[model samples]
Target: MSLLFRRPTLTRLLLLKNIKQNQRSTICSKPPKEKIGPVQSTFALCVFAVTLLAPAGWIMHHIPEYRRQGQNTST
Candidate 1:
């Protein structure tokens, strides 16, 4: 076991080295190319919120049905 795991292989070392070089910086300080108006921004935020919450709300709305099915299956 010790012999098999003794040293880092050449490919593994190269992979780690390449990974360090592949990262990109996400920092930005530039002003907007096209400014979004308040109405558009509000619409975008509302759509995003509904997209994230709708599925969870549907599941929460059906919890009683799920519980009834589980009880029926166990019996």
Candidate 2:
């Protein structure tokens, strides 16, 4: 299609505008305030810990089975 051969000036202009807006925001915007309320903070920490621990727990649970399989394969 002839449309495919068209120059991307409009697309480039929009991309450049977004980049400039981000630059302005980064330079001008204040950082978010830290949340210190105990209940919210505790809940956040618990969620984060569980998210991290789930994978670790999975790995630990699989290790013994994996080792037993390896032992059987060798013997």
Candidate 3:
């Protein structure tokens, strides 16, 4: 039917128009990322260190495996 074909074309046109409008809008600007303050920064660091501790420990435990492989390959 003509409607089936025409509806998709109309929808495509509307979508293109919306995309162009969005491209022109300055309101799409990203928020500025800045240091929240020393206290917040310290808290974030503490959380990060806690999160990384387990992963770091696992990597450390594998150090002998990695070093052994490297030594064998070099000799």
Candidate 4:
């Protein structure tokens, strides 16, 4: 009974050790990297800025219409 429990624990430890070794080896392998040029960087920035600001721009554009409708309904 004791052997049954101990065997699983030892097997688990061995499996965990193998997983850690594989992870370390994979992480240590490398590849060269490319740099982003100015045009690419500018385009990326424009896309990022538009994504960040488009929602606010849409809401700002619609606020006056919403206010006009609210005024008409109250009157």
Largest TM-score belongs to which candidate? 4
Return the TM-score for each candidate structure: 0.59, 0.47, 0.36, 0.61
**lDDT of candidates 1 onward, in order:** 0.92, 0.91, 0.88, 0.89
lDDT, candidate 2, 1-75, per-residue tens: 598897789889999999999988877566778847899889999999999999999999899899999999998
Which parts of model 2 have CA positions greater than 4 angstroms off? 1-22, 25-36
Worst 10 residues of 3 by lDDT: 1-10
lDDT of 3: 0.88
lDDT of 1 by residue, 1-75 (tens): 688878999998999888777754445678999999999999999999999999999999999999999999999
- List the candidates ranked by lDDT, beginning with the highest: 1, 2, 4, 3
Clashing residue pairs in candidate 3 are: none
Provide the lDDT at 16 for model 4. Answer: 97
Rank candidates by TM-score, best first.
4, 1, 2, 3
Runs with alpha carbons beyond 4 Å of true place in candidate 3: 1-14, 22-35, 58-75
Each prediction's number of clashing residue pairs = 0, 0, 0, 0
